[model samples]
Target: MAQPPSPHVERPGPAEVRDPLVLTELKRAGVWAGVVLAVLGVIYLAEPLLLIIGGLIFAVLLDGGARLIGRALPIPRGVRLVLVIFLCLGFFGWLFWYAGTTFAGQFEALRQTVEAQGAKLLGWAHTHGLVDEDRPQMVTQQLVGSVGRLTSALGSAIGVITSAVLILALGIFFASEPRLYHRGVAWMLPLRKRDFFYRLLERVGFNLRRLLFGRLLGMITEGLFTWAMLAAGGVPFAALLALITGSLAFIPNIGALISGALMVAVGFSAGTGTGVWAIIVYFAVHNIEGYVVMPYIARKTVDLAPAAVLAAQLIFGALFGFLGLLLADPILASLKVALEEWAGVDPHAEEGEEVASPE
Candidate 1:
């Protein structure tokens, strides 16, 4: 009796106690998960919708500043919003028109260069023994075919007008009635959780807006610098190249390389001297961007880790394709905030103290 003193019992920690419930819910909601998967699958299938949603999200992030501007200015919010929208439309329209005109003017020159280079390239390959006598023609043909396919893909515009319209509509709705969405979200939660949920939404929205602004600033800088270099070096289609580079800048590492390589190729096609100059200019610009521009912009914007961003892009891109790629950072930022909050970690915790917990 005394020797068999009542064994001490220890209570499970909160997480340990919650595990079984979580597991049970997961098991019970396999059907719900399946439904979610089906819905996401359908969304992916409707690529245009996905793109429109993405564009709307981008617009919301970019135009959030319009609210502050409206408040501070003499103009009403609605008038300020209209002005921002008009400015955006006018800027993009001008870019499109300029790009179109530039491309059209350069098309014949590009075609001629490609034709001339195709023969010269094959001859050089043969002379340098890069290809066997029997394979030179086949290899050249393959190269040409590859280029043709790439050009076709790049030139094929898809749902631009429709996506623009939808994005504008969504942006207007979001700007006009953002509180409605916040209220709707808050209403979805219990009374006790509503405040927390609203805070989460606010954090998410802030992070998204910050990320967009940072990216926009970086892209503008990159595009302007690249355009200036190209123009100085007498590269054809400098404006178009800048536009393309700026657009692709949203894609991160791969985008920069692709855009830079294309610029070099365009330079090469222009002439040897021009090509050399373009290469030097681009290299210098990229170095400046990577070392100076990106770091500053990232500091000012969202404090996302590069690795986190890359990992998110990879995961989401795998799961949802292009839309997923576009939404990856925002999604990851949201998840990061949620994880931090759930783990009782401060959202504004110091960099060294930041800890990511298991989902």
Candidate 2:
């Protein structure tokens, strides 16, 4: 006898199954899109706040690492942190003292040179067709006027000193109690995702530290090498140029070009031979940096595309001025990491997938 007809089991309607999957995907996409828009909005609207907070966060993370190193070594964390801060303060103090002393000497020498040779130099330029007889005088007057205005502006900005002090105080406070903030952050997330969130924080902290240290190392090396070259070539104000170049190197592409241009100008001001030598030395140092220093330092830092960094700088600079340019790289790197993690992709993954052997 034939078995009774098999009991038919009904499947969910097409609408029922397709609707949930479609809804789930739309929801996921919507959440992510909202986050992206929110981040962009925050960056656009609150750039100054973002920059200050970012700087504080970076400082705290760096201090935290110093504390960790202190713990790992024989020194106490407090002692280590104190030493680190003192070293930093001492370095800046020494730099200012040196700059002031050198500037005083250079200023006197420069004044004597200008006074003694100003007319002769102007005549030479005019004779060589480099400038009209009146042009040199006009340019000199403009430069003097500009310098006076700059000095006046600086004198009027004494309040900036107080503001800087306040920022430093805030940074120190955060560095001392970073955990309190971290704990508060962790508390904001659901218990199930707290661990992941904490890990993300740690990753961000690590990346920021790497970027800071790498940039610092590269700047120092570049500055020192540039200074050595200038001094060897008998350039005036080698120390000052080195300091300027080093500080500017922290700014990436624009910084390098600006520093290079300044060096070349200083060279020309020194003399034709000096200018040529300076150009040679600049290129030599730059080559070493580009080939040797950057690659090595980058290995220890966050990997970011130069184009992306430049773009971010341009966008943020338009929105927030110089502060935005200073922070573009780190901000871009953080966003890059966040995007990679959110998309479940490895930022440093190999370009192609591996092939499987057929059985």
Candidate 3:
């Protein structure tokens, strides 16, 4: 009775045949598609991404402060972090309270002085036949434009304040319990890759903390020395110039040039003697920091090539704006560390390794 017309009939499935074309082309195409999408996504989300990066950097700073305090206080990390935050806020408040109006006036004077100096420079160039008469005004305008572009990345005041607030808030949250976020990130990654990711993070934190500590030390020394020398030399806007120098030192190569130029310009606004003194002071401070201090710090931490750092700065500055420019070095350093780890090569090993033949 043929099982009385069974409720189900079985049918043979199709044979599992190999692909006519190899998977190599398909895989290459998929990878290219993925890369394209990622690039588009990054461009669209540049602002938020930059803010997040800023928060991370700031968090590292707060963490460093907390760790330092812990060495002395033996207090809870949360309390230490709060103390660090309050100290920073107090310093900023003091800075604004002390110099806000003075800085404003000095900044305007600085702009006028720079423009006037540029005009005089063009005149001299023209007189010496170094610049064509027709090009002088254009050159001056370009000079002014470049100066303006320094802060153009900051956008409007409201935007600046908003970004700062977000960064600070994010930094506080991240610093309060960085491990939670670290583990969260690891959880999303493959189990096999999680350990590697954590290792990379630990290495990154170590390098970043050292790098920033060295930077802060340099900033303080440079600023104080600059202010003292300029004030003694009777240079115009000594306080303002020192502040600029100190703040800009956070940036590496390009920043030094800008601060030096501004200092010299303001010095000239006072007199030729002061201008010469300014040049001397600029070189004296920077030469010591650049040739002595920073190299030692670089060796102790991550020693990135000067050319690589400048290139990263240019690219980041172009792509993401001022915050990007500011973050470029740290980001590059982090990337270098990550890549070295991924390649299974210890970045510092080569420097200290002893070469001994097998016995």
Q: Where does candidate 2 have its weakest 10-residue lDDT segment?
A: 350-359
Two-way lDDT contest, 1 vs 3, winner = 3
Q: Which stretches of candidate 2 lie over 4 Å from their true place?
A: 1-51, 57-61, 64-68, 104-156, 159-163, 348-359
lDDT winner among the candidates? 3
In order of listing, the candidates' clash counts read 0, 0, 0
> Per-residue lDDT of 1-359 in model 1, one digit per residue for the tens?
35754559676767673578888887779979999999887665656555555655755753676765766788766777777777777888897787677687675665566566566767788889987786767876886675454333123346446555776677777777778877986788788777667666666677677767767777898789888988988998787778778888787765677677767778888789998987897788778877887787666545677777788776666555555666677667667867666675764577667443323
TM-score of every candidate relative to the true structure: 0.73, 0.70, 0.90
**Local lDDT at 210 for model 3:** 91
Give the number of colliding residue pairs in candidate 2: 0
**TM-score between model 1 and native:** 0.73
lDDT string, candidate 2, 35-146, tens digits: 9998888765663475466557556545855766766788866677666667666776897788787676775664554444465667788999999868988978986775
Q: Name the 10 consecutive residues with the lowest summed lDDT in model 3.
A: 350-359
Summarize candidate 3's per-residue lDDT along 1-359 as a digit string, tens digits.
Answer: 35564559765556643565646677888999999999999998887898999899999999999999999998898899999999977887888777776687777778899888877877989999999978898886887686467456678788788888899988888988999999999889888787778778988999999988988888888899999999999998888888889988888888899899988988887889999999999999899889987898898889989899899988888788788889898899899877777767675776755322111
Q: Any runs in candidate 3 off by more than 4 Å, and if so which?
A: 1-24, 147-152, 350-359
